[model samples]
Target: MFDYIIKNTSLPEVGVKNTIQLLNDACTIPFISRYRKEATGNLDEVQIGEIVKFKEQFETLEKRKATILKALEEQGVLTPELQQKVESAPDQTILEDLYLPYKKSRKTKADTAREQCLEPLAKIIMSQKTNDLESVAHRYIKGDLNSVDDALEGARHIIAEWINERTDVRNNIRYQLERFATITTKVVKKREAEDEAQKFRDYFDWSESLSHIPSHRLLAILRAENESFIRVKIEIDDDRALDKIFQRIIKSNNACSDQIEIAIKDAYKRLLLPSLSNEALQNAKEKADEAAITVFAKNLKQLLLGSPLGEKRVLAIDPGFRTGCKVVCLDAQGQLKHNETIYPHPPKNDSTGAIKKISTLAEAYKIEAIAIGNGTASRETEALIRRIRFKNDIQVFVVSEAGASIYSASKIARDEFPNYDVTVRGAVSIGRRLQDPLAELVKIDAKSIGIGQYQHDVDQTKLKTQLDTVVESCVNAVGVNLNTASKSLLSYVSGIGPKLAENIVNYRDEHGAFSSRTELKNVPRLGDKAFEQGSAFLRIKDAQNPLDDSAVHPESYHIVKSIAKNEGKRVSELIGNSSILKSIDLKVYCTDSTGLPTLQEIVKELEKPGLDIREQAKVFTFNQNIKTINDVQEGQLLPGIVNNITNFGAFVDIGIKESGLIHISNLSDGFVSDVNAHISLHEQVIVKVLEVDIPRKRIQLKLHK
Candidate 1:
């Protein structure tokens, strides 16, 4: 397994071995990446993640090999040569091919022919050494054999099955599929004029090389096929495919060879084409799924790590037209202080009343910022709020309301605010999201947040697994506050799961806030291993020991103390003192187990204890003149925020109902391989409108340099 993983990942053998050992110990990825740097040779989370993926793949391959070997043995055909072939097969394709001939299935044409006593005739024809094939086949005129043609046809069916089972034939055709196959589609004739079919009109008559098709396009084509709007086919050049198979089976031009030729064509169509074509297409789909999942994971990570607004009193409004705007006031710690509703748009153009209510509420709650949900009536709400004069300057921000409704109806939301309805809950979510994105976003489903690409079309299990890993990485990267983090956020910490998180929260409720990291040991069910894994990622502000607030683990406090002792100062004094931190040689503290990587990390943590790696959230305003898509024009420069990214492009929210797309080509004049390399989620940027299709609600944009 180690050799297999090393071969696949091309990582250092020692690092791979140690990482596997740590994984065997059930250590979390974030913990191993951050705390076990010395043992892992300083591999990052991604590299360690690759090791984990390849290790699982190797295990799955071995399990499949074992299953195949057992099946072969049970069939009484487990020859030593066959056993060696199965054991040495590198991948699923080859291993399955080796077992294909012996696999049990529903009675096929070949099975019927074999039942008709045609096995000897097939072997005779396959040798292609006799000119009187029909004469030889006439001997099998027993059961179900009416004439010489029947005997020959039955023997041909057996021969076709044999030709299809050849490992070399399957491999050659698979190569052709992998290289030259084209995925073609045609609109389902009945569904051609339907409304849903129009969405995929571009794919109605589309054809692209399977190998060169983009991931997004392939996923789109597949989705179209799944919806019954299109008929999809995988094809390769027939003559080229047949020629390759014929070269391998045809040894002479005798009557037996002619019979074998007929069987070869039948095999190529009936057995080989369908089986290998589906395999090739499924492989392409899996690759496309992997690519799409990667894009979604990256987008989710960026959205999770978006800039935070810190602790501030906020007034949030979930904008609506006829339903009015749901308003909620939250304190600096994101606790809901007040909730109400105000009609500020259309039917109830009660601007005067709404302004008075907003101003009075802002003053009463001492609101420092306003977060307006960017939904229906969002522009009108922002305009109304901007007109009001407050005693203190309050920054107004338009927050994306994506997935807010999902959270509003969730059980977690009900647990947080039992008395408030979903509207109030949604408003509060918007306000809290501004205060700290990672903490609040973790409460909602990552998929529902609307930052992914082809999320539903990808493999759901793999998508969920990757998204969970991203969430965990983000949560650990920005250490959670021990006393204040919600159960959802706490659950994502290194080794703490939902149950442990709930227990920790319950313990905090029973007894006030924890004072230090050591107090975690007293929590129910939080054993030594959990504490060791999770303690460093949980921060405690104003703790008795300053190191508790920083990322420095408890096990390494002795090393920090040693450094302070050498500097002739207290541990607290050494904390954040750059001159003192810089003067200390990390090499002096390096022991056999504690290397420079660990010591260097400790010093860096001491410099900025419990520091936020994210930037502070800033207020953004869209064009006051452009309220809807109708106002947008070609070549118009506008400010927008990147909301979603894919392999092909980034979608920007340009202060309108419809977001504009900046295709990968428009990202820059130079070639761009990764969308994230050029733009990020939630990044404010200036863009030039390229085109707008009002009917389709689509807009094209180019990044403004």
Candidate 2:
């Protein structure tokens, strides 16, 4: 079944088996790749990620097929042949075509005419070789069908509508229309005053293949259309379309070829064209959404998996005016050490006091860093901190407080700091976020994280669904610390929710600590399914269960224990034993239900234990010297980090606030199309600067050849 699906679909060959196994085991893609490397040929995180997405899409298509088949079966129209065809349909589009006749719809003209007893005349006209179309019209020439011309017109209309309803005709026309369609976008010059229209001004007279337009450009055009600043219409060649349909009908009969031609043209102009155009538009929209969602997911994953600065003594300041700069100091473990309010900006302003407070706090606590919220007065506050110049060196940096206010008023924030004021909590969160971004950032909603494009414009429900999945994948990829993770973080765990997450936290609070991953079952509402999905992703470092310290699932514990016994050692000693593991007979313990496939996986994980799934690196601090495009020099070699990689190019972080583009052509001395083939995420590389545009903040680079 897995092989058949893989052959039928576009899934990559590298991780297909492991992906199928992961889906069956209910293990997430993150868990499988991070913990089961040997089982998956050591496929990198990205390839496995793609396989996971394909598996989900395949499952969704299967469910859709089942629903369609049942609907047809209940209608008593499901034949064995039809059922086989529907089941074997390759994609949702084909399945929908098979089910079109049975699918429910709103009132249509053909159905109304059939109700009026015009079916015989309509069928005769469709046959087109009857003694005469006039004779057929004579039978239905009554009431609304009065007069020969009226009757013929009604019959022709019915024939046209019937031809339109044919699934084959509709599908063929839709395909042709998509292939031949040109999306034309026009904007009214007068309505371009709105700030929203500025982005679309360059696209006012745009025309492109419906199938080839990029998602971002398509979305921009759609936004312009919605605002009425632009009128977009998809155009196709009518003659080619008419000829295609006419040939199909004409081949059947030569007697009424002209009548059929008229009918075909009418069907296309009135019925097929409009409906298929709408479908084409919808297809374009769906493709755009998928691409946009994929990009959004990738960016979200990177942002979530960003290297944590780790717990450090941090001084947080919410640079402000009316309330003064609210300051809070957190210890290395994020406990509030002290809090103070110093007026620095305006009104009861005292720069001296503010500087004194910050310096004193830095010196006394030996603060390693100061996190200043990037709000109205952040730069001013940073300047003040720089001037104060504490004797004990402290690095001050601006931190984006995009959702700081939202978190401050949130219930989780209140519960975490019941005694502290909202302002102080916000300040502390800002400071802590810089120290450990993944931990503190998880406290806020993923949507509020500021990584998406047109996030507000897209469907909120769909965006949330995709973004939530991304957050879950990222959170699970880097296994969360059971002791330190917040409920917000735990809630993203597969099979866990806000309520269950709270229950886990409360259970831990009441009891001392989670000694092992299996202890989660003790928490109320955490059932077998939740445990199966969430256990592999939650780590209890230095815990009682050695497997918990590693990513090996609880279900595989007995297998590892047996292996350990075979080696004449405890399970603890068996971990990290490559030679001993290779000597074991994996098939000896494999059962009919639990195949060797899963058993082999269990053995491989035991070889390398307690692997930290997250990227291994220290927190990266951008160089102060390279802060803008103007700061970059042509032909200068700069040490940088690869931020993103795509087929066409790579975006690198060169210590400038903005990332630079390294096109694939410039990536190496040899030919290269895929950026990933040469560069990877977080990989540090040296590149010679090629071009720099200060106004656009665009820097182009070529890799060191």
Candidate 3:
């Protein structure tokens, strides 16, 4: 099944062959791609993902052919030639075409003609030898065929059914439709005045070549058609299709040939066109689905790998207007130290009291930074925090609060903090996201993270599979801390699942901290296979052996120990000693099981053991003078952070509740194709306001060069 994937996906043969074995053994993609780099020839998550996807498709194609062959055998219609054809068919479309003639159907003209014993007459006319059409029809007009016209019609019905069932005819017509069809949509007359329909006004009357239509446009048109707001269809020139049909079926242009032409027209109009149209549409949709999923996966990867403000004593705020703002202080390890509420805005504007409380908390906790949720009353809360005269310097960040609410109300959150209310849990999540995005974001569902478009409308199963693969890749890339990581975060690690993760956490709680990577085997249900797949990506700080604190897997400890012994230094001294690592030849330790790729990674790990792959978070502030859209004038430049991205543009949050759009056309001086390729989620940039519409809550902006 993976033969097609290996040849097409550009991965080395041995790598794909070995990786398939690991995948068969239930190892995850992240584990194979990261820990088993030698087995995959250093193929990253994208190639691995493609291989898995194509392998599944190939299996499905094979299964469908099996079912069809079984049905044919049961019907007593299976022959040596037909069985060979069915078994050799490559794709589902062609396989189904082969099965069409044998499929049972409702009563039709062809069935009636066969029952009347006029099949022999139909066969005679199809030979196209005699030009006497009326004479040929007269022979079958005795019994069920009442007259010459009835005989001719019944014969034509058989001819038409024969034409419809020909594999060549259906394939040729489908080729024409796929190459030359145009998709057109128009608003339904009765639904034009509907308020819900107004959202699709731009597609009220739209027409475009199917080949040239973009994914976003196609999905939008499909959504509109599904809602009954528009009538959508695909069309090809009728004469062009007729020319292809005539070339394939008609033999001569005499009187009898006219009857053949009539059958051709009836077959196409009654059967071929509708079937090919549906096939063309299905192909277009699959293309569109793959495109949308690609965009979504890229955006999700960026969000998961966003910058982190590492391990800080911080203050978090989930600000609101009517309800008082929820405030919480977290220690360096993200443990909740204190919680309170302050009314700093609107009706109960306790500015003086809020300022005093904030300053006192900052001094007492030795807060290094402030993480304020980017939500209602956020900007106002930021202003109040800035005004307070703290005894120590603090960096202020506006963290995206997209899925904090969902996490706060989750079962995991309740389990983690049983006594805290949702508000306090929400604030803690905001602070923790700044400290480490990959660790915190994994707790909530990736779909709720606000990065993808039309997520709910795409194939839910495919979406979940793709997103899960991405999350797993990100988690394993940045190794986890065995003692400090949460159950949700640990569950995403290479081989550990929810149940294994719970056991690990329970073991830690019962048996104090893990002092070495070797201790993972002591946990129940974690065998040698689990340890091999996961131990490399699990880091233990201050472990008994220095290699345990690095990404060098336990299986390779002997090799690292050998290098250290050759250098006449302890393993601890070899770690972070670039001078010593530079002199050793890694090729000396290479074996078939431990190739150059694995050895190279080991040397790199020695140089910088247990390093975080992500960058440190930077503090950003919106224009203080422009708190809302009403205060913004055209052409004013302001600082902002990218909040959401789509096919057309990226939305930049400018400190108010609403964000502004930076369309693809305005991203640069030259033409841009994909917005995500140029920028990313949570990226900070400067922009100049293009236009603002308070009525629609829309603001247009262009990037400041």
Candidate 4:
């Protein structure tokens, strides 16, 4: 099905069937090559992910075809030929064409013409080989069509309306417009408008590759257009496009080529061009949406996997003024150890007391790190920490508390800390977030993460749906710890919801800790379907069924036990032995019910049992000496951490609050196609400082030669 779409549709090669299979199987690029070995010939994740997206689009098109067919059939217009056309429609644009006449619309010129009793004349002109357009005009020149010229004009109007009404013509024109259109944005001259769109100043003369324009930029241009501060037009060469369509129509009707030419030109100028241009712009917007979602997903992944300070006790401070500074200490597992308030910044201004209290807590709890919220008087708090000169080894870092307040006021926070004050809860969350970002972050809304670009500008429902999917995929991809996971984390599990997740937690609390994943079924409301979806993803470190600790689904237990028996060992003994497992002939296990594909996966998981699928969270220690951009010099090779890898670039951490951008072009001295090929997530690479802009907080770095 996917192959047929790829061959017939305008979808690129990157969007293919095999690629989607690799992605759907969750086989890592390295694993796919090392294990599957034969399948895919080892295409990497990047390649596979692209293909998967393409396959999804193909499937979407198929669904749309079915919908169009049903709607047309309901209207009694679905002829055999029309049905075939609908089924074979190559893309969404064409599929929409098959539905357009039946599609709901307000009021149209063709409808108006039909209402005015000019349907027959319109139909004759649409046939194109009119015996005489003048004669046809003469026939309709009675009521509304007054004179010969008026009748001819009305006939031209009717023909244009009919041409536009044909779904095929509209679809063709839309495609042509998208292929040839340029998004031309021009400033409305400050004096002409209120200039409320100052953010779009750079876009005043911008003309982007219509297919590749980023969503944020597209939204900005649209906002400018909406506010009337900029006039944005989707310009296409109408004459050239009309000529191409006319060539097709004229070839079909050779005798009326001249009349058809006039009609085609009139259709484009009066009807087709305007409507199709709007459709093309909408197509451009959808393209932008896809790209934006891709970028946002990548960034969200990076943010979710951002280096966790690891499981270490932390002291967090919410720097403040009149109310003083709130201080909270959390243990290695993020449990609140203590809480207090010290007058640090203004009003009370007890800097000495703050320093003494922080140092005492650091020494007493042996706090591994101190997280100071980057809010009001954060710098002053950091300065106070520096002045204390603690005897114990403690690291102090300034953390962004973007959503700390939101979490503080949230019901979840209140539930987590029923006894503590909201401000103290906020401070504790800030501290714990640095320790285990995924765990702490799951407690808060994803939108508050501040990683998205123009997140507010996109369709809120769609944005939420897309972001929620990303979060769910990320959560499931990295199996959750059943004992430690919060309800928010559990809620994200497939087929699980807030109510069920809460029930699971309450059940755990009411009873003892669940020794096995199967026990989840015993929990109220967690039925067979929910268990099937959630069980494979939830991990218990030392469960009764060892398979629960690993990704091996329960349904594959019989196959695993048979393999164990064949090896002359118990199932538990074969859990983590790679040598014995690799020697077993996988062909022996392959059967009709258990195919080679699934059996191979089961064998691999058994060899390295209970492996955490998530990329290991790294602990990064910043070089405090290199606080400012000016502290670094050109040609100085410094050790930096790879923070993210995108198609266009990689962001590297150079011990500063802001990460430096290492564009793909600057990644290496050799030809590099992908940023991932050159660097990976959390990779420690040596980089040379290329340039720094302190004002903009931007740094440019090049990987060391």
Per-prediction TM-score to the true structure, in the order listed: 0.99, 0.79, 0.96, 0.79
- Across 60-90, the per-residue lDDT of candidate 2 in tens digits comes to 9899998998898899999999999998987
Scanning candidate 2 in windows of ten residues, the lowest lDDT window is 615-624
Per-residue lDDT tens digits for candidate 3, residues 1-705, read 656776567777777777788788988787777667877878877777777877787889889988988999999999999999998887788899899988866888888989988788888778888878788788777776689889878888889989889988888888888789999998999999999998898899998998778887888889989999999989999898988888887788776678888888988888888878878987898788777877788888888899999989999999998999999999988999999999989889998999999999999999999999998988899999988877878999989899999999999999999998999999999999989988999999888988766776678888888888888888899989999999999998888989999999999999999999888999999988888888888988888888887888888899999999999999998999999998898888988888888888889999999888898998888889988779988999999998878887888988887889998899988999889778888889999999988987889999897
Q: Model 4, range 49-79, lDDT digits (tens) per residue? A: 4455556677888888887788788889889
In model 3, how large is the Cα lDDT of residue 192? 98
**In terms of TM-score, how similar is model 4 to the real structure?**
0.79
Off by over 4 Å in 4: 1-80, 87-90, 101-136, 166-175, 190-196, 212-216, 226-228, 245-263, 319-324, 343-351, 374-402, 418-422, 458-465, 542-548, 556-608, 613-705
Candidate 4: give its CA RMSD in angstroms: 5.6
Pairs in clash, predicted candidate 3: none
Clashing pairs in 1: none
Q: After aligning candidate 3 to the native by TM-score, how far in Å is the CA of 392 from where it should be?
A: 0.8
Candidate 1, residues 13-67, lDDT tens digits: the string is 9999999999999799999999999999999999999999999888899999999
- Give the top-scoring candidate (lDDT): 1
Query: Top TM-score: which candidate number?
Result: 1
- TM-score, cand. 3: 0.96
The order of the candidates by lDDT, greatest first, is 1, 3, 2, 4
Better of 1 and 4 by TM-score: 1
